[model samples]
Target: MGRDRANIRVDLWADGDWRGLSMGAQHLYQQILTHPTLNYAGVADWRPGRLAALTKDRTAADVQRDACELTEAHFIHADDTTEEVLVRSFARHDGVIRHPRLHVTMANDFAGIASTDIKEFFAFEIQKLNQEQPELALWNHPKVQTILKAKARDMKEVTQRVRQEEAMTFGSATAKPMAKDPNSVSMRTATATATSSKEDIPSSEISDEIPRPDVDELLDLLDSCLLANGTRKPSRNKKNREAARLLLDRDGYKVEQVAWMIRWATADEFWRANILSMSKLREKFDQLKAKAGVATKTPSAGFHGEIDVEAVLGRDVWTPGTPPEGLDVAGEIAWKKEQRNIHNAERLAEAKQKLGIS
Candidate 1:
């Protein structure tokens, strides 16, 4: 039997794949995630008969079909010969780094509950992962190694349990280790900051235009708009801060305006998928503004209702007959027709103003 997991963090943005899943497959995925056997190892028996019992009114065949669906969707991996399944992203989803001891217990528990074939498969898988690229090997994960280290410490201090508790790695608040880039300066903070005294933090990453909380607020907005990869600050600090500086100081955009742009871009179907980072946002700001239907009108350039159609649309708007050089005949005709409409509208507006019409 496996241990209980009280709750699992569900990242709604990352799990957009769930929306397209069949109801049966969705149900099966949920059952597997919450199964008692899905402990620290995140591997469990893929026995259709056993899982079928959990799915109300569903047959073994149905469970099998849904299992296939899950496998195809990269949600779970199952071996036909061994009848064992491993949740691919389980360790990541469960924050395994924070619960190293639990993983050790689950790996140990697997020997008793799992069949011989399943156990053999897991061993083989771990061995292959080790021989090929041990860094990515499931058993050799940092968390697992951390657990082994803690266990060794415990055995050494068997007679001093209180001391063991104090020295334990998994459950201690002060001892909790955060993932960090080895090259980057490590600055563990409960909240985001605009400036850092650390030598590793480049001057470019810091911005004086926006306060620390404001930068954090923009980060929060980006996190909501973007999918986070198991980190508190989702966007790269240097890129994000640089983009913010451009928006706030160079471009002369208000904080509220930048905030609105974040909201609008994230909410837009096209822009949402495109604006993954603040740097990308700053780069495509003009295009996004145009996409948001910001077509500003300009004063008439010529006396004969002639207008700079390009200026009005913020881009080249081919007018009838006089299309920009090298435009094809058909494109010229299209532009001419569109230009006629604009000319007529501009003329009407002029007439109204001359007559003092409201």
Candidate 2:
């Protein structure tokens, strides 16, 4: 019969294993044990999603996690396919097993259990109860024998299935295989560098007195790229902020160039950990561009307007570096720098004029 009332031990709080359970799991355990419809057999419906809907500020995932924790702790056994739970100690603790008169009631409740896994667990507990209290003498009872025989078949099927799985996969002993989805966010952590050779760093001096909004956007992009590359989030304090501002505003580095460097450095096996800060990024921009195989290469020739590698590596391995025949590599760099200086001058002049600065 579904119990109208449930008994709880006060010493339960003092139990180290019980206290070790997460508060959510502990709450769920109590909820299940005290449920008004909890049957004599300790088996009950375990619908995490439906239970979550009736609770405050808890999702189905939270309930599912709690259920798993309880199951792992051996406080309960849950069968996902059957959506049912068997509280391991319910019958013994509730005095049902000790009272031989209650066996009929327990058998009636057992008939309603749909989970073979739960039935197996329940039968094992009954055998233990019989040994602990031989006076009850339930070991050879018709009901106990029937439950044991059913679980025996269940165990045989489980053993056969495990054997078949072992014949199939290398990880048959493991619970599950690791994820292999290519497009998933998970990625191998490439090497990361926290320090760079200071001698190789360029002087990053900011000329503009005001903050550049575009530079801040570039810093945000760098942070996002770092996370995407499976690296820890890089810091974005004012020191790095000013460095990026100088890189774009005074050093003539284009926003697109900085964006490309940010992505390449974060994804590169060697550079991912090293160029973690904007100061490092700005100081070693030329080195990064060269390592990226684009120091003297034209910017607008490759996939999505990046460096054209075909030009770097000639049309054929035997041919000389193509570089877009007669493309003045040095002249191009100088011209771009000169244009950026002119643009910056115009922008500075406009700002000064607006601010009435002589």
Candidate 3:
């Protein structure tokens, strides 16, 4: 040989045969043979002829050196009852060729190693071998490189498709319109308009249009009527009496009419006394006229004393210490005319009683 190192080729022997084998196969064979009951007699018998044939192509010295190299390589044991052969090619640290061998024996002659198990075992061993001797370029073969690349591309395509589908679904959901009934907008607008109109209406306008009776006038009439009958005490305030008298004189509502409007019974003593003055209308008029120095010029019973001038005007025509004016004179004239009727009625009643009228 030109160079002994270059010419060196490792020979793997199974039992005694020079077989081409893998590191995984060698480890598996060793594991099988380690079982005490495993039979290797048939394999050992077949090995010598195979070894002889392998060496026929090589010089004796080279073959012997290769066999020695193979023997020195590490061996891993597999379980007994495994019957298969595995082989691989590797290089030594010094660049010498080493072929590993596998010889599987059945510890109990039941079954052989499964193809999937063999393949998985081989793959694991190859990975280990690559780790141990990274410079070994077995995984760099074209077929293995092509298969790995194809698997990577297929995985990438599958991932991209899944992401694209997910994104499309999400976009469609977000873009979908919210459900709205056709009439909802119109209803909302109508409600809002009604609410705004109600808010804009003023309370004062509503109050002014609503009709009700004047409570003050009704109450004053009740007080005056009750006092005139002696059914209630006379009002202590002169102003209240004057005010009530003025209101009644100006309106001249009939007793029954006043009672009906004020929801009082005409038969009630207080109602009859206040409006008709059954007690003292005549006497009171005379007293007031005397105090005011008003003269009763008529000898006829139609006229009596000075009238309540302010009472006829429907409000006070003169204040205390205030001199009478044109309006007061007019009010006095009207009051006098009303008093004359009352005095004539009284005189007529007296004349009727003298004649024993029923």
Candidate 4:
């Protein structure tokens, strides 16, 4: 319920549920999972008007439809009569709960709900857990055991209907139970997160060869490059992280390619002025590549009237009508000398060829 821990873990299970959901539904589901108060309890008052106040894009009807989809997918449970919604798997954890007290407190809160459907659903989940996870301490809790026994008949009847509904909706009675080891589930989930390797990434039938950048290293490199090129370092935020993730993880840009582009853009007088951030860098990446292609190829001999000192020095070493920055002066002089030497050597070779020297 605290804003200090607003972020929530979005496991890879979402991929399966996403298939039948509309974009609006997925967004609403995320809102439910991540909303500060709702995230902690995983239960919310399902008043349509109340929910509509929180979701501007969705009407009350849309909210109802989305909630139904989530229920059909077994992502959540909603009782229209009581207006209480519950995320079915919210209390389920693959591993030992990090904070048992907090998790226990939250579970207790849900257990106290005054709705029959909600109580039955929670009791059924507890029974399922007891069967699948006999080692878990929840099964040993006297109160939890009592609740399961007390609701035994209702839980059995409700669970059977829920399974039937699931089969009718999804062609399956229930999602495959997760393995006991949280690590196994985490390993599978890893494939879906930004850090996934080539093998983990799903293909269309099913996913790229470009090595994903180490996110930390990539961000550090961005800052270093910006600082070296005299740009102020910007604070890292969600938008910046997203941009970098898209370019490196999703867009298949190599880390080196990103570094090269960042270097090139920040040194190009015109581009340096425009591409001052990672978002801008991602936006102009193709243009930077095209420009780099032109620069690296170098004009064929005698094909140019004006020398592009920028191309020679890999930076804007000469600005029109003014002396270049002192930082570039040394590089400019060295580049010009190298160019003259190459030009002279070429002429000498041509002369020797004319004179029939082997």
* Model 1, span 158-226: residue lDDT tens: 212322232242234421221111111111110111122122123555545646666566767777755
lDDT string for model 3 (149-264, tens) is 32111212322343333234324342121011110011111223233223322233334334324423444555565544334432333223332233344335433333333222
User: Which is superior by lDDT, 3 or 4?
Assistant: 4
Steric collisions counted per model: 4, 3, 10, 3
TM-score of 1: 0.32
Residue 107 in candidate 4, Cα distance off native in Å: 4.5
What are the per-residue Cα lDDT tens digits for candidate 4 across 163-282? 443234323422222111111111111112222222222233111344434655667787887678555665464335556767776679767667666766666644554454565566
Model 3, runs deviating above 4 Å? 1-114, 144-358
Candidate 1: list runs displaced more than 4 Å: 109-358
Q: What is the C-alpha lDDT of each candidate?
A: 0.49, 0.58, 0.29, 0.50
Ten-residue region with minimum lDDT total, candidate 4: 181-190
In candidate 1, position 215 carries an lDDT of 58
* Candidate 2 vs 4: which has more TM-score: 2
For candidate 3, the 10 contiguous residues with the lowest summed lDDT are 178-187
Off by over 4 Å in 2: 137-141, 148-358
- Model 2 lDDT, full chain set: 0.58
Q: What is the C-alpha RMSD of each candidate to the true structure, in Å?
A: 21.5, 25.1, 59.3, 25.4
